[model samples]
Target: MMEERKIGRKTDLRVLKTQKAIKDAFKEMVMEMDASQITVKELSERAQIHRKTFYLHYTTIEALFEDIMKDLFQEYCRLIEQTAPDAPFDEVNRVFFTFMSRQEPYMERMVCAPSYRDFSDKLFMTMMIHNRSRYNPYANYSKEEQNVINTFLCLTSVNIYRQWVKDGKVLSLEDLIELTNRLFLHGISDVRHDL
Candidate 1:
């Protein structure tokens, strides 16, 4: 029994390492080429793993992409939770952008990727479901209204990030955050008020 347990633990560790290597290779490939262009054979070679091992973990490249997106979303959620425990939505947004700015290279690639729209939509939904109490700005609204507001917020924020990345991030992180906050919180009224 003791020997079996030891062997099982060893197998688990090996599996984890294999998966990490595969993921790392995938990330590197994605940074260089479009995700749709990456093949399982190339991925396996890059990871230094057998093709059968790749099949053991993921059935398709799309599945692997989804898994990676899921992992990234989970990490984003963890950053939010860690940075501002029980904080309000605005504060959570601040913490989120701060965390994302630190992950600029990864974020830029992911946001600009061809699969980004679907990935972002799914990630937004996951975050909404996972942190309903913390991130729901439409808690008092009806279900339909909540959906509309949530969609608007997600699209707006994502577009802003995409533009920032496309512009080569000319603005500092602080400036970017302030711009986001101004647009989301005060809207055009702040600039109009000055006029």
Candidate 2:
């Protein structure tokens, strides 16, 4: 029993290490060039893993990209869970704030590097973008309205994040969350009226 447990743990660690290696390599290549231009051979070389191994893990480059996105989102969710135990909006904001705080240095590096201009955006778009018809919140809305809402909501979130990063505001995660929730629940006119 003890030997089996030890083997399982070791196998888990090895799998994690390999996954990390692939992700890091992919990030490096993405920084160097367009994601569409990256090939599995290139990824395998950068990751220092065998081509067969890459194929074994991911059926295609798109699959690998999907995996990367899933990992990033999982990390963000984990951060949320770790930083906010209360499950309230404010607490959720704190979690977001902590996650953003951790990402500050990475964003700085990405900005200074110049080569990674659209990498972050691509990652965000990959994770967040969905067909209007598939949007969960828009299930009740008409098709045309759903399309508009989907586009508006996506653009709004992306713009806010871009502006926040560009302005270097690093606003309190809590404030950001509160503002986001408020804006989401109430229109600009409503906010103005409240003020």
Candidate 3:
């Protein structure tokens, strides 16, 4: 399990914050440059950190990616927890809408860079994996059945999020949730088949 180390309480929290700032800066800078063309000096300058400090936290620009990917996954998981399983569709939609309201900006920035595309793929993978395990804890389905539902959700949810972002976030959070719930809960054959 990934330990939730609260860096804020420690002296090194500042260092951690600085590292985050550097990475955030790097992310913004890379959006404007080819990842292959981004040099350590440029990244350091963008992040406002000394070259030595950047090196201390990461060996190369690529190494910073691993850490950022981990953070992206963690953030998504945090958002998923804010949603309620038993809530009405509108309520659930609100939960997701609220979640996206917070994430839309960061995602918009991250997706602009070529280096961050894989992070988007991994984000979908992580959500699918999580949903398969915990989405409906009350449903006693076989593993194969669960896998099918997870796969469907994985595709639909990712697409919805992508569309939501692309649509300039026109829908209210509640509307997004209601639409999703209508599709999943009320639209299709409610009877889930194992096949």
lDDT of each residue in 1-195, candidate 2, tens digit only: 999999999999988888888878877776667556789898899899999988878899878766765665667655644532335444543454455446644343443334444544565444334222123544688978866775566556655655676767677656676787777667676467543
TM-score of 1: 0.88
In TM-score terms, which candidate is top? 1
Ranking by TM-score: 1, 3, 2
Estimate the TM-score of every prediction.
0.88, 0.58, 0.65
Off by over 4 Å in 1: 83-86, 133-135, 192-195
Clashes of 3: 1
lDDT of 3 by residue, 1-195 (tens): 233455445647888788878877866765676556768888888778889989888888777766776676677667666766444545544554465567545466454344565666666667557643555643698878876776676567666766777787798766777678777777656444568
lDDT by residue (1-195, candidate 1, tens digit) is 999999999999999999999999988887888756789999999999999999999999888878887877878778777744456657766776775666646556876666556765677677666666555556799998887877777777767777877788899888888777877887877656553
lDDT of each: 0.77, 0.62, 0.66
Runs with alpha carbons beyond 4 Å of true place in candidate 3? 1-14, 30-39, 50-52, 59-63, 82-94, 111-115, 131-145, 188-195
Note the clash tally of each candidate.
0, 0, 1
Deviation from native of the Cα of residue 68 in model 2, angstroms:
2.0
- Between the candidate structures 1 and 3, which one is better when assessed by lDDT? 1
Evaluate model 2: give its TM-score: 0.58
Lowest lDDT 10-residue stretch of candidate 2: 126-135
